[model samples]
Target: MYVTTSGRIHNFGAGPATLPLQVVEECQNALPNLNESGFGLMEISHRSETFQEIIDSAMGRLRRILTIPDEYTVLFLQGGASLQFYMSALNLLRPGDHVDFLVTGAWSQKAMKEANRIGDASPRWDDSENGFKSIPKNGEYSIRNDAMYVHYTSNNTLFGTQYHHLPDSDGKPRVLDASSDIAGVPIDVSAHDLIYAGAQKNLGPSGVTIVILSPWAMKRVGDDLPTMLDYSVHSSKGSLFNTPNTFGIFVLDRVLNWVEENGGLEGSVARNIAKSNLLYEELDRSSFWKPHAKKDSRSVMNVTWRLPNEKLEEKFLQEATIAGLGGLKGHRSVGGIRASLYNGCSIKSVEALVIFMRNFEQANH
Candidate 1:
């Protein structure tokens, strides 16, 4: 395992999660005077040419990494993916229009509730009763003929479940909340009409949400929509419709630069797979570790599991934190353990975690 000279421990928090050290360092350097423009990063004006170049670089790098279509519009908006839940529905739906959801976890549940405010949003497939341990196969759900679009979360951060295939949307437009696994996994940008992700997890930091809109989605925006919630408005202004998250965008751009330098999207996917595989292998090695998600639906980013009991789980968390590993606690909604192996999480960190798990299991058992 690679030990940090700066004495930073491994972080496994779900969001506002770990970031690449190089990116963090770059941000640190820019804090004083970004690009020697004499304006501190946090103090840089959104309308300034220097900041314009930063946003452009970030967007351009994101497009290249994801291979987003030329016609697709990308916006770096605030309010995170939570806002997109309502905004997406508000822009895409009118009264009486139907929308279908594949509710895999809490976030999707919240999304469905928000969408209901706009139209007849209902879950076509919901795995909540089964403890959100698996993703539904295509045939398990049915889409309504009148459905305007089919929405699904690509990865459930809390439950450690992820979809490994493109969902069957019955030829309807597909809207996705890829918040937890945007550039970290394999995604066909052309397949979905709209995709939104919170940059904190796999991209950079909180306060910025990336939204991609297909031409179809843009044209479908309801007339007289709220100016800020309207996609076309942001698209017209190049995501500068408001003040924007200048600091977050700058960090995100640095993170993307790190991705490009290390190996683009393919590299990120491989690294995440390798990290998750190491941890999952340890979880599978002993009965002491009970993984939350089913094998077929396991997440490559966040790995969730449990110990023999709450006492053991608590003991594990405490000891792990003392051992220089942190943020392994599970979501309060489903208490256990969760280690998020995002793009920024190093393989060395996973290796260190696996070693800790092995020692803890043996000692506790």
Candidate 2:
């Protein structure tokens, strides 16, 4: 059996990213028989009281950490944010109902496409002209007051851009896809009508998605929606409408507990800012490296940059991998180096990466 030893490499993958070592260890200890239920976590039934406790604990901790408002219902459901792209449209919009989208990067573009398939989705504004390096100015988008909802991705993982401030929806319900940077930073949950995130990034493992929605948003859900695709159905049943991702939820619960113990959303945001600043400062100090995103729009969670050329980037990736720094390669759609500094990434790891970057630049230049 494979075991995580003290020699674990610093992970920088975007999703399925690194998790707190303490959480992993706790899960390891409980895998055999969770809560002394005589059955392993994977072997237990989802309908059991033990599993209910686990899910409830996960929800409570998430609420405490994020300060989720009392009016919003949190549902831990199957399918990643991709499913939510369509599910949100199905429940909240109908044929000919217009939904405004702010396309910042690949993920938001996909979200718009999905919404378009179900409703009259149109881009309020797109930053494609700038290669998505910066977010659109506040007044740039022409938002329609008649639109049912406005959808946006909080952080663009591919382009390394993030919206520092949310758009003014002008009383329109806002749907936010916060998959990449959910728990890594603080957000006003009440500011959004619907917020969805895939668990793999900052929350936990893959296979589960977290959806937090207000009662106002739930009331707008379309009638005769598919049983599983209906947000109201899952919310009504307390996310126990069907067999959920038991193991994933279990890990997520432990991860949230880790977040609370360390501090909360505010604490996590401070840590993320410090880590990203370290890397950004180092990148700015070196001409050999070029950060992809603009200064104000850069993502605290995913710091993407490029070397002088593709050959240099390839060499850097190879050397970094051998030096125990892995998953530095960026997404294939946008080829470059991306060091994702998720919540689980420690400041020491960022410092080590910055040191490696400086040495690499010096040796090459």
RMSD of each predicted structure = 1.3, 1.9
Single out the weakest 10-residue window by summed lDDT for candidate 1: 1-10
TM-scores for candidates 1 onward, in order:
0.99, 0.97
Number of colliding residue pairs in model 1: 0
lDDT of each structure? 0.94, 0.90
Q: Which residue window of length 10 is worst by lDDT in model 2?
A: 1-10
Which candidate tops lDDT?
A: 1
Which residue runs of candidate 1 sit more than 4 Å off their true CA positions? 1-3
Candidate of highest TM-score: 1
Q: 1-365 in candidate 1: lDDT tens per residue?
A: 33356789899999999999889999889999999999999999999999999999999999999999999999999999999999999999998789999999999999999999989998999888899999999899899998999999999999999999999999999999999999999999999999999999999999999999999999998788889999999999999989999999999999999999988999999999999999999999999999999999999999999888999999999998988898999999889999999999999889889998989988999
Flag regions of model 2 displaced more than 4 Å. Answer: 1-5
Q: What's model 2's TM-score?
A: 0.97
